[model samples]
Target: MAITNNRMICRTVFAATLLTAPFQIFTSAIGQVYPSLTLLFALMLFLFYDVSKVLKTSLTMKTWAALVLVQIISLLWAVDIREGIREIVYSFSFFLVFGASMQESKRNLRSLTLLIIAYSVLTLSQSTLVIYFRLIPDVKIQYLQGHLAEIFTSPNTLIDLFGSERNNVLDEAKSGGFEVNANTGAAWVGMVGMVTMGLAIGLRRKLLFFVSLFHLVAVFFSGSKAASLLVCCLLALMYLTVYISKKFTPSRFAILISFVVLLTVAGSIVVAAGSATDFGQASSDTLDTRKLIWAHAAVEFLKHPILGQGFGGWSETFQAYAWRQKISDGYPPHDTLIRLWSQSGLIAALVGAAFMIAFSVEVLTLVRSGSRTAAWIGAGIWCGFLFVSIQGLGENWGLLGTLRMSPFIAACFALSRALGYYTSPATRSSVLNTSVRQIKYV
Candidate 1:
């Protein structure tokens, strides 16, 4: 009977849940609405959305059980058991929701946009909450109290995270190593910010502009140089696309051209204004720190090729090099891929990179298709995802690598499916079969 209504209620609820949650991503401590809210929605769907009725076994849809199985196996061997297990729990649910949200075989573009917007709101609001409460409680401040950018270069490096003046940084009490790792904060910002810009430009939606803006703010506050730089790169790419396209009439072209000019002007003004603010100094310092970290990461990667060491092996292995070289760091290898290879071995890196490459191809196709909203969203989503990926090259991110590997990868898969980015021949045949069944009922 529920199937008779095209399961409209189920579909709508699933759509709304994904849309809202995608918009509000943030750090764990932030009072963001995404994780809890979306989990509830997934639970409701799991309870009522009959798989036998709505979903046919098809290659087009994401293989939920397969993902969960892989995650479980990986968790069993992971160096960080609690984190691995927690990620698997979150990712399993995430994949299920992602795979189940779309209709038949088609992608829903607006719903996806809504999901991205929801994350933006939740992240911005939660970030505000953190700022208001001043609840950035990290116990290890002394670890990062001094060495700003002295990792790669001499002890007296030119640029410092606290700026040219280390005393000013000490005065501000922003010395926690993990707190400023950027991967810890910047990762989330880049994840949301880069993607939103691409979405706004591709969709021609006004709301996404503000969505992009808030994400930008989050990136700034994260003090992650990689995040901020990626933002500039992604935004520039989006704008350049618009500027180069000769589709609009002269008036529309002029309007767009003028808007771009004004945007650049406004951005410059913002930059100049920010130069006087604490964020400007902090951001500049963060950028410098990343360079030092990047240099260190490159060296580590060079030392351990092919098999590398085992998982959780980088910290110990890296210290030997660090001590011999005299690089000051609160922890070991800074880059995500490098650390993964060092710890989990080359096999882990290949498995992880394969997913990224597959997802990227899917996203690229969606961008070029031009007819589907799903396609366009894929383009936008990748813009954001890439920023995170680039930043990942510098820091450990998620469940598989940087951020929190499972959720990031699962979200990628889910969104990819939503965009019709991963449709396969078997899946297409299954969808055709589903349509035939629906027609018989009619």
Candidate 2:
């Protein structure tokens, strides 16, 4: 009974962590504190329940630990010690979450799937709400904002707790629901869409298929070029996978090809239409800014190619570099590899590369483990990871050192490891079969 109770507690905390993860973009203090607390609680529960398992050392863990160690050591020369310490703490949290997710995945795959589905549904609902309000006319937006403010607080205190600025609050009223930033929100929704698509195809559930479509459509409202492009790419990839797996009759193949052509044409139309709008111009401006930042980041990386700037030192380094070049102090490094190379140096970048390679290999192993269910789910998780990684190309949040979306990435890594373990030859007996049966029933 004690063991069962512990499992229940662990599962509840795990669910809470994933469900609240979408709200991590909330700029308020509570938005940050609650998710962090849940993560910390989950880690503690795993430690208390199974210390040995939690502490079990694996190659991936070793690489992750070494990477963390490098980040810590880099702090010795970091421009801002406080920022470096904060980043290190976030890195440690990600490590803990990664281990906990692996343990949770092994304990109950069925529960994990249900939790992920629930998370997807929640994110979908949030995205739907945001898109719905965004479609409303600009004239009534003020009225809607005022009404929402009245419902939440006094008229004088109009700003929502989720945002610090009135303009941000108004933006939230217009198009942001639970997530403060459109791009981040779209990325979260895109990740959920990938997982939902996998579950829909794997489980052959019609409702989940519609949910996935909704996710795809809703992401466009966020106006995140990366999310939009990657989700479409993933969709095409999914279609290709289906086409390759089944031997279709001539007519069926023709139908599939026709569908693909239509999708391609429709996407082209959307792109053409969007490019003529102010949103397109804004996206172009953002891309130009990213290019500028990347160029500056390359110069900074070249300056200290060996050790680079210390951890959390990129901002200061960029600021100084910007001053020297007589350019406006722009954003920090927009690319993850660039961030790592410029901040932690070449050695840390090598460690990061090794960790990513190991991580990808584990995920791929699950995808090709000869289990249809595991393969579909693994593929979805991989797509989700890929989406975030692509997002990292134009954003600073990598697979580590931040709370924004790192937990989700860590969860993906953990689930991949767990699924790989379960489908391995040594564990492919009663346990794996039983888990599959449970998933089927679910």
Candidate 3:
């Protein structure tokens, strides 16, 4: 009875965590505080359930731990120790979330799927709201921000709405929803949408297919060129996965061909429309600015090639470099790996690379494994992972360390690993044997 109660509590907490994940887009005090608290609570419950199970170390986990340790050690040399500590805390939160997810997944794969679907639906609803506001001529961006702030605030009051007064809002004309950056919002929506579509195909769900299509439309309303391109690539990968997984019947072949042609036409239309608008010019300028920031970040990385500048050291280094070069200030590195390499050094980079390689290999192995259901699901997640990785090249928030999308990315890693374990032949055989023994005793 005690064990049953504990399991119930654990499931409730994890479900809450997954459902609230979409709200992580809010850059408010609540947004920051709530996720951390919930994730920590969930992690605690998971650990309480089975400390050994949660702590079971693998090569990937070890690499991740080493990476975190190096970052912590680098704080001794970090220009701003306080800032470095904060960044480390944020980064380590992801590790905790990942562990909790692994434990939860072991107990109930179906529940996890339901929770994920709920998360995607909530995220899509938010996107729809943002798109609605964007289309309203009377609603200003600040007005939308204030409304969202109120919705997220405690006691339903708008008093002291956190991050409401933005010092630097990116692309005011774009539909960023509650996020500070439009591109970041678009990327987040796109990722969730991709996962939804993947599941739709894998599970043959019509509702999820429509939800994903809505998310795709929301991405367009966001006016992010990079996100648009990334979504296209993600869709293409999904199609490719379908092609590889299924037998090519005549009817199926025609359907696939139609999908390809339709996607091409739709993409062409979007491209042509964007080029005709000022958004195209703005996107071009943004890319140019990113290139400049990347060049500066590269130089900074070279300055401390071995140890690199410690976490939070990049701002000061870049400031000095920009001053010397008479460049504008307050720009981020924008790229994930570049930011990690610049801030944490080569050790972190190497560890990150190793983890990615190991993760990819594991996912690939699952995709080729005996379980047909697991294979398709794994392929879907693989595409989502690739989407995040490719999108990370142009943005800083899609990787493991960043606060914005790190939890989502961590969830991706956890889900992939969970699928791999639950679908393995060994696990299947064990379950079969256990069932047989139980039947004989009965």
Query: Best candidate, lDDT-wise?
Result: 2
lDDT of 2 by residue, 14-103 (tens): 666666665432223442222344445534544433423433545666777887888888877887776676666677766666766766
Candidate 1, residue 416: the lDDT equals 50
The C-alpha local distance difference test score for the whole of candidate 1 amounts to 0.48
Cα lDDT of model 1 by residue, 123-205, tens digit:
56434422322225232233244443232112322234345324212333322122334344455655656666555655566
Candidate 1 lowest-lDDT run of ten: 149-158
Give the Cα RMSD of candidate 3. 6.8
Q: List all candidate RMSDs to the true structure.
A: 11.4, 6.8, 6.8
TM-scores of the candidates are 0.57, 0.77, 0.79
lDDT of 2 at 311: 65
lDDT of 3 by residue, 188-287 (tens): 7777778777777667778878998898788888777767776876688566655554343446535544664576457545666676578666765676
Q: lDDT-based ranking, best first?
A: 2, 3, 1
In model 2, pairs of residues that clash are: none
Error of 1 at 277 (Å): 15
Q: After superposition, how far is residue 226 of candidate 2 from its true place, in Å?
A: 1.9
